[model samples]
Target chain A: MMLDNTWFVEKSYFEKFAMAWKVRKKLHSEQSKFQKIEVLQTESVGKLLLLDGKTMVSEIDEFVYHEVMAHIPYMVARKCEKVLIIGGGDGGVVREFVKHKDIKQIDLVEIDERVIEVSKEFFPECTQGLDDPRVNILAEDGIAFIKSKTNEYDVIIIDSTDPEDFASGLFTSEFYKNVSNALTEEGIMMNQTENPFLDEWGVGKIYKNMRAQFPHVQSFTAPMLIYPGVFWTFGFSSKKYQGTQLNPDKIRHMQSLERSLKWYNTEWHKGAFALSNFHKKKIGL
Target chain B: MMLDNTWFVEKSYFEKFAMAWKVRKKLHSEQSKFQKIEVLQTESVGKLLLLDGKTMVSEIDEFVYHEVMAHIPYMVARKCEKVLIIGGGDGGVVREFVKHKDIKQIDLVEIDERVIEVSKEFFPECTQGLDDPRVNILAEDGIAFIKSKTNEYDVIIIDSTDPEDFASGLFTSEFYKNVSNALTEEGIMMNQTENPFLDEWGVGKIYKNMRAQFPHVQSFTAPMLIYPGVFWTFGFSSKKYQGTQLNPDKIRHMQSLERSLKWYNTEWHKGAFALSNFHKKKIGL
Candidate 1:
């Protein structure tokens, strides 16, 4: 955010587009083991987080990303109990997972512990779930953390930063194979793929890699106001269940929690799976 | 767009957020009677149009806005023959309307003549419809022009800028009554409402204004990649047609046109009308 000419801008350097907010003040700045991290207080958009100068999450619109990442797949799956979240150190996804009454365990494997410490201090709301007994935060490389698991998690979420950084290995064929091996037979996994229009990291590449390892692979989209392409997409790979099909009873049951949400709902869920022709073509669906 | 040290940015001044593009060069800049007009050659995004420093359209993603503005309403209406567009100086919406074989007379009333001239020279693809015999280009104050018509057009579209400056009158209650009188009994009018998330212009106010005049008022959303709040929303107000109901025959027919278009499809159309909980709360729906 720009205050007295002090502005924070995240440039999609190669793509030539950037998102900037007027800075009220700089909350924190430091170098993590894996990346550079900074939190700024914006004039309007609440607290903002940047890792390696890339937009990771902001307080105001973070719900859209975290809710779609955790709630959509959870509601679509037949059952979810043991869940693995890779690289969501900010605790936003962990917060959403804590809302699910059925989930008993949540393992968050983040490569950087500094991100978690900073998040707990600056964005307290997102970090509230970290205090819950269900959560287990692991400060380890996600690429290395998923190696030993076999048919373990009921749901797996990859909330990595842009693939150009340390998280590049998370969007590979071998990573998908390891994730596939780590899920139960009817498990579901979702990776935070990039925007549909200007996804420089390639949402199609994630779709292809996940499809090679999973029986049911669907790419759904949502509007993420701060992402490079506000028209953001997620790669959903499942062993069983169609992401498009919303069971009537399940939808009715989901409505009870509507009062608690800012964006996701039964209607939004249906719309999320209706892929645009642009997406269908990219995935060869 | 930044070339060397030159970067073009649009700041939502009150909102404290902005979009910037790395510039290859500034093609043209002039002050029109209405607003500051500019055509910038961006490094990545092809041609960029700016009105008073606000992004109006970009070459690469203009189709999403134009197609959604024209196609969704055309397909939803029981029948559309005569059409009217207000303030769409770029001619993108007119080009989409011209594609409908069912549409006959097309009247576009853009207040700024320079925008048309700049678009014709810099962005010809958006202005091709100006060559069609069915399309009429009328440079006038659309608010005043609509006041003279009554029950004349089958479809009316308001491709307006943000509801500030001179366009503030366009969002007033009086304009809604004038538009209601200008439409045939079953006519549909869609306006380019702001983004779903960072809707600094107030989509709910437009919904309330149109709901007072029209029987069926629906707010549908699409992702305009170049637009602020890329999760853009459109206010669809009609005397009868429900924008959400996809008539099977219309769906079958819309599928035929899918191959020719880039984004709009039967499924995407269905998804467009699903209001998010945030939108619902904002609109008091």
Candidate 2:
């Protein structure tokens, strides 16, 4: 029996006419038979979400987390048809990937089947496209799953959580090396580094480690309303493409995204890359 | 008896290997007090100290808020010596005003004696220069205080809170008329508007109200790290000064002070005015 406790918090502001939500829940109970993942929905000064205590995809006020995590690499790679997503069982990344009509396949490697199952039940909006024919859901360790592949994925997105508990090994340098081996020569990978305001050093360390294996490395900070702090930083490492320059057609395609997005627009796309001088000095950008 | 059960939350981040704190406190009992008088020290996110949760003055972060609020007006007015501060009971505004050295005198009208006394205790760094001979601390209603003065003040800074309680009248058309009456022909007035991300309409209303009274109205966004969000916006309304052109000496002064700050710098100063296109369009700038 997994502990089933999730709470939702909503914070509404009158000025901007916007509301932010955060969902929090316990992941396990000693009395449960299988590992339990509890999700809660809550709102803060700056994030929005579907408030149910089981799973969440992205905060409404700040969608850069999902947008940049999925689109940066998708737009950078020459032809990102066969992509692999590790730990994004929430289906938000897959939903973003499927936007590219060119993407023929997406291998969603999730370790715990329970998270996907819970997301499907609790967050239908976020998991709507996970069962699409093009997506291949594999219940396995992402690291081992990557090691077994050869020149398989053209783009890889790591949508894991903080480097704590089961997600600990995911942040190791070894895991990045495995990911590098699994990608094609021109493949690009973008990972949710961590909160820059809270984890600047963590971001710095990841950038240093990613640079060891990849020829090009860059990090950009995006404001996340769901997260606790100012903005979250995502690390982009690639073998060929410079993350800043995107194909004009692809940029046009991204801009033409008809989806009603609350955040992440063209100006935001350019601004995301325009890092603060302090951040630039720290990363030697 | 006052309710003492207030929740204080602090978010700290490490930058340049030093810790910076952003704090938020919720008061269950003092909601009305903030509405009536326009100052809520405990709930403010900046670095200033709150004496018994009421009075506020400049912290180290005070320079960021004061310089932009003061220097902009001074540069615009060309020879601004006489100034009036509404609700700056903590004397932070007066301290920034005195930096001009040429300024003859400043009349600070604060409504609450408690706030000044408390600020004198907790925020000694900011209030230290408050007792200067050129400054006069008048404890009275800011609106009534302004009505009594003629075209005396060259600049006026309305550093009040949201238009929820005591500060509600500060956002009215009547207040703007009185502000106009109090300023010299080329005088300028700046108000510390609310968070642009959280309270756009609140700021929009102030800009609209100020525009009704002044010939030139411009709103600029400044990054105050300690605020609820990373950025806060300030509205500058004037009869003569162009908001963009700054005195070369003041720019140099700001540049020299960049090394002493953890947040505000020259890049930030320029970026402060770079509003989102949406905001620029909304404000009709």
Candidate 3:
């Protein structure tokens, strides 16, 4: 469940550092069964969706996070048809997936239904694909939902909150095993690993455990301007494909189909894997 | 001169967004002739030097900023000697210069002397090369210092504070032309350009102005974890060579000389110039 948030100064103590945003107005606030949610109009970053006092998505820089989360796996996988997105109630991840014409189905499993409602009202551009005929919105626990399915989804995107509250089980070794079991032979899973800058978050521990569960595991980083730690990381685990080996033809073709993108591109896709030496030492790569 | 700072939450209103760090202790504070200077021990980011209420350098992640500022120019330029560092009284930029064995002379012109003394006392690692035999520390205004030199330095690093307060003259076209006159025919200049995320900073305006003063101009970005905006930019203006053209053999030989580095590498060196589409559009590149 989301934590209660203060209205004026949204301060988050990420490790020893405190990141704050000046709020113009509190658009909405309510306590749902699953978590507390708040929508805020900020002076600079436009609208913000805070789940448990944590910035889930902001209107200004959401594209950088969502694009890498969705497009990196899609462009790498030979064929991405049936997709599964967990905890992305804001619909940003789903919107990125709907850009591909070949994707037949997308199942968005969000634990809280209220997040979807608020995002639909506030972030219309981010939630554009929520009403697609091929999309299904399932209100349930993502960990339990993935446990129920086996070898069904072609691509799995774990766009969940930090693994501290309701999403704690999603970061465990057993849940990763279940995620490995739930994917098809050629499927790849993309999970939002926390920032390494905050050592208390134990991102390296989760990455090490994921490596034990999957045949191929790698991590990539991108800058998320509003996130507690601006340099954010993502965990990419694959069953049959190496995340680094990209089919340039496929990426070019995808670029042709979905022409305009703000952040992700062919060069950035390749460069994302070139982990900085500082990060290499931090993650023990 | 440095500015007085609050010892609790060091709040900075960057554009419409606010970035803050929790201060553990105020190590030192004084008013220099030019600006206000404060040395702060932050909870997360170690020893921070604030000039005119702006972050000049922080101990924890200062390497990221200084390394890129110095190494990018050194690695790209065919041969870097007789270096000029303007406004880097903290000696972080000079420390990077000392790593290159070929650099014969380093002329450090700093407007404020207290910053150097504070840095030597608090950030010894960053100020290591301040006492090197090759270094000549000039206690004078950087804008006036550069105007007096003509075709004298091989590399010019404008490691000044933001183009505000005492360093406001560094960002003007006339100052850039003076900087151009102070460099050799094959000289290259690296200046700290502010983030585009903060529209009030006018990084695009500075980039356009620099383009008029130099034959070739390009801007590259890197994540400065403790800066106001994490995705920070640096402007690279050249006279004779493209900034991206690197002598790999020279870098390899330099790596043999200076072995351990936290951020800069051959891959990252090239990737740093790979412009993000979002940034390209913002800067009208």
Candidate 4:
């Protein structure tokens, strides 16, 4: 977030694109052991959460990020009884996970504790689901947490920040292999891939690494209004379920619960997988 | 544009968002009766054009905007002999129109002559098609020009600026009626509607007005990196054909041409029309 109190600008040095929001004031600020977390109330976007000077989530448009990350993998996987979400301290991912009726358990592992406190204080719409009885919020390093488990989660959603600085290890090949080992044989895993325009090479490299470990790997995009380019991508890797194949029965059920979603739908789910020629060549689809 | 020499920031005061680019240097600046025009050579975006302090286009991601705006209507419309483009002074619309072998004539009506000159100097990639023998460049008000014509063109694309200030009249019900009359019985029209997040009521009003004039109306979205929100929408109004149908044979032929289009394809063409529930409800789709 920008240091200035009235305005918050998230400038991407490498990408050379900046996004700024008009803020009312800083609501909270705390420097945790892992990262610095701050919440700002904005004029239009509502409360904004910043980690290490990077805008993580806002009360407005958080649904785009949370819905895309959680719904894509959760909807595709057949048996989504057990789910693991890593690095979603704001609880937006958990908010989406609770929408699924069949999901019996959810574990959210966030390294930074301050983000949770900020979310609870500011972004209640996103953090409200953390109070669900089925959810288990664990404050731990996701890499180490995933490494200890095998055949555990039916679906894993990494709602982490960009793969740089404190979160660089999450995109490494070793972490992907560990994630693969932790998931059930038919489990699906999705990581929040960076913008293709800004980090084409990085996304390609991460997709390559995930492909090396998983049988089926693909990338999908969603509108992230606050991100550098506004369009953010996600990498999907599955051991059994192909991301493109959608079950009609599951879609019918999801259609009945359409009120829970804002951005994603069954048609959009199929359309999101349809990458452009440029993106298709980049990820070698 | 931001006054800073090394960086140019496009901030939308109404939307409460800003996009900044690191620039090498300023190339040119001119003030016309319509608006202020400036050209800047950027580090990554190549040549950037700003009209009235609003980003018009950049060399790097112009394809995403131009391709989606031009190809969506061009590919869907069966006959493409004659076309009318209103207010695309940069020539990006004409550039994409000439790609079709069937398109014999294109009439480009741009109010500001300075924008055309700037495009010729800095954005030749978008202006090369302006010199085609079949293309006619008219320096006049698009509203008055369209008002005089009837059953004139197979496709009419409104590539104007946002519906504000001088261009506000273009989004009215009477203007849409004029556009409907200017088109052939089976003609199609596509307007560069603004981002929904920024102009939800404006887009909804335009969509409602267009629906009253045309039999079939639809809205599609595309990522415009420099816009207020990354997701920009386009309004499609056709007299005959449904917007969702795609011709497989034409797609095959277009693919055989092998042009290096950065951000459009047959699959994406279809995918672009798949609206999210939020947008669908907003536009009354």
Candidate 5:
């Protein structure tokens, strides 16, 4: 038999045996907020959130979730000077948003103070720009915060978790209406919807509701390794801006920001909007 | 704190929790060839094989590896009649190859009788045509079997595992030389090289070596969920065919094969070749 003591095959078997040792251990913790959150070794791809145990951004290769959530609105809004971020306690979103030097003020509404504290401690690299004077961190409910606000912000990003307990309101039609009310006439809103691979129906529902409130609704997908599914889909809605009218110049400007990015690049910005034929057919894009 | 007990968030949380269960327990399996291969569930997403076992087709999403390994050869050789698939015991590649009615015969050389045995037992839908008269199954080492063959095969697919143990010989330039010698003058060869996300260096090295022997050498990437890294890449080399010269009629004919595929649609066929500008520059596409 060809399988007789082949050195290469045997070495592979040995390597597989050794990998069992390298697999990281996972730890689960229940917060004072009664949230059951689990933390694990960042592993080969995910990064350890140095500041907080409650939240961690997977490594740069998995930054599609953050990049799309931030860039889409920044690209759509013609003049996004004042922005509001809801529940992005990790500060990665703020870091991407501040890239637009024109962003004079940023209001980050995070309900859990612990997520910010944990992120500040564990994910220093991702949260480095949190101290920027333009950012005002508000530990409050995002829905309530948006409801009280007038048409003051140029862009609003709902960077909340999956539509679970505390995050459920973020997915509601009422929340979307409130978001529409909170944005200026030309404002654009983007939300971290969920894993389309598993929750296509849920994502479709969100897209439909957002369409009802906003004149233009678009959904885009990106790969996220840390998420339950391989791909995470996000939805964007605007009264004035259309997704197809993506300003190439603004995207090029964003691409020139760091000169070095492992994941998001110019081609990706355009390609990310190019959905699978199935999705395109479904969304009528 | 807006996170107060909300039913919508609760429902979303349960849905996400249930998806986690499905991924950990039902969708993905931890069993290996040395251990035990189990089918936690069975579902079809076109002509693709969704094996839950770690070894059968180590990756659940085999489109990336299978598509490049299958399409490149068919694209290169304008007219391919006799095709040989070695070690794709799961029948995914065979399903792709059978798309062209012009393929007169497909000889599947697989050593681990257990692979085909298990595939037949669990992946009945994908393996539906294994018993077709045009297919010849050789329960033997692919290397030995290929060395004994003459210039009869028009396309040879080495659908083996990683270049670690049993699959080590398959990766050697020597095995490729054998493949080159076994093919007809106009024949082509394709193989699942490695995970580009984890082994770009290794893939680059293999691509370099393949370029030495074949007049044409190219590599393409596709997304596969079950691989060590989420994305997988495959290398294609041939003495006579170019991937860009895909005959429109031939592709249309291939699509006519009633094997419904979730990922490999005509648009995907076009998009698969649409490399990222960065990758295109790297590969000199």
Candidate 6:
């Protein structure tokens, strides 16, 4: 970390609040083309990944964020043979997708190859799916890559970083249009929006941009430990899905994966859509 | 705060993680008859109430916690006219209860009178309900107070602090039996159980204790900002009523106070019970 101390502190959302993890060991530190990447072994959250001082994933919350991101939209859709992941170099999303044997082709387009490399070394569990024969790891700019595709992916997971600088294009109107065109008619796209409490404006902008292109745009929330607000949200914009619908077939599908999942479940999938009045009021949902 | 610094830090749950709030100003600080009480004007959370170095209530999250605490049981129960609140010195619970005109009487028993007095001076919004003609404030020990009453209150709200030192008794089996006996035949009680993520042992103990006493012991969670894990939970133990059950009258009751509440709603109430698989496994629910 940039700080020369035992604590790795995060000051995001205009320094409104700060959360510190006691540094047990600094696993890796480097400057990637996108941002500063650092992997730290912490006292509490175990292995912590930081991109430009913002917490991206940890050993503690990785299962929760990744499971919710990958499984929620996958279960909602009727088909999931092909998948495209953008900006998830950490491979957590890929690992979740790998759990389901039905997925035939997997494409992970991460702008920073260094993130994937680091994850393979420091966070190998998340990167195990990268070696699967059905998977394709494309180290390229996600924004440019999506514009060249059409009606391809059954499920597209935009595991983008914070909507800042280079990654900011991920939440733009032009990008949403490309994503809409990139997906099949029954496609569902889930993006890690941001903290519901801190990033209301950013989240709202993403929602607005997605709403213009997609017919169904909804949000689901889950509490994440490393996140600034803890109450984190994921934006679901699809061509034909309200999501969280109770289907007996999907219940069996969820039940089959029960022993593997630590976070996502059929009951939770339905429950995650429950947003408080203030949550809606803040993000203009 | 004990620390002579700009940040008010909380190191709870064996300091597995730490949350720090920047102090704009120290509004009040003192050692009460029980524990240390401090009220601070914070940069992010605004006015915050801290009891014995633990974050209690903040302007940003008070509505979320207090609303969930008060309204969930109130709407679930067949009757909520007579209520007893144990250890809610800040009056946040009372404030929520006061919104329901159907509630005829409320008795608030707090161990520390200073928390109430300090909140009255610094956090007037939370304490405004204390002035209601039907509300009564008693600066006495709740553990002893509940033992004296039998079948008196229709609902009991245990807004006690962490199960530490003097407040620890609030989560004990004996105390729970006393509380169950103190309530009417068809009564409900809600306690501010600690963070489900951080306090698995502590939370499980309370659940086991409550389960032994009440036939129905369910839990509901909300994202509280100042708390350790931020993913906070409350224990719902009732003689009857599988809460969050859809009732038109209760929905109307929740909707009537929609303008007054920032967090609680009928939809969110049912959703709040949606615990992640990891969350259920962690707390052994």
Task: Work out the TM-score per prediction.
Answer: 0.96, 0.68, 0.93, 0.96, 0.74, 0.96
Best candidate (score: DockQ) = 1
Chain B TM-score in candidate 6, rounded to 2 decimals? 0.95
| Candidate 6 local lDDT, B188-257, one digit each (tens) | 9899888776764467777889989999888877888888979888888888777766446767756777
In terms of TM-score, how similar is model 6 to the real structure?
A: 0.96
DockQ of each: 0.57, 0.12, 0.42, 0.55, 0.10, 0.55
Runs in model 3 deviating more than 4 A are A1-7, A10-15, A257-259, B1-7, B10-15, B254-259
lDDT of 6 by residue, A1-285 (tens): 122367788876676577888789998999988789999999888899999888988988888888988888878888788999998999998999987888899999999999999999988878888898899999999889999999999999999877778988899989999999999999988898888666634677778888899998888888788988788888888888887754355667679887678888888888878888987876676
Candidate 4 per-residue lDDT, tens place, A146-176, comes to: 9999999999988888777768889888999
Taken over the whole model, the C-alpha lDDT of each candidate is: 0.83, 0.63, 0.81, 0.83, 0.62, 0.84
TM-score of 5: 0.74
Tens-place lDDT digits, model 5, residues A1-285: 011111101011111110111115443344547354444453344443322222335553435566667766777678889999998888888888777787899999999877777666656766877899999999999988888877988999988766667778888889899999999999899887665434433666777778779988877665554444444667778889776466656776766762454445544554455455445544544
The best candidate in terms of lDDT: 6
Per residue, candidate 3 scores C-alpha lDDT tens digits across B58-78 of 777888888889988898887
Chain A only: TM-score per candidate: 0.94, 0.80, 0.94, 0.94, 0.82, 0.95
Off by over 4 Å in 4: A1-5, B1-5, B13-15
Model 2 segments more than 4 A misplaced: A1-35, A40-64, A72-83, A102-104, A147-155, A177-188, A196-220, A236-247, A274-285, B1-85, B88-109, B113-117, B125-141, B144-157, B173-256, B269-285
Clash count, one per candidate: 10, 24, 9, 1, 19, 0
Q: How does model 1 score on DockQ?
A: 0.57
Model 2, residue A183: C-alpha shift (Å): 5.0
Candidate 6 lDDT for residue B193 = 82
Question: Candidate 5 chain A: worst 10 consecutive residues by lDDT?
Answer: A5-14
For residues A153-234, write the lDDT of model 3, one tens digit per residue.
8899999887787888988999988888889998899998877765656887888888889988888777787887577888
lDDT of 3: 0.81
Worst 10 residues of 5 chain B by lDDT: B5-14
Candidate 4 reaches a DockQ of: 0.55
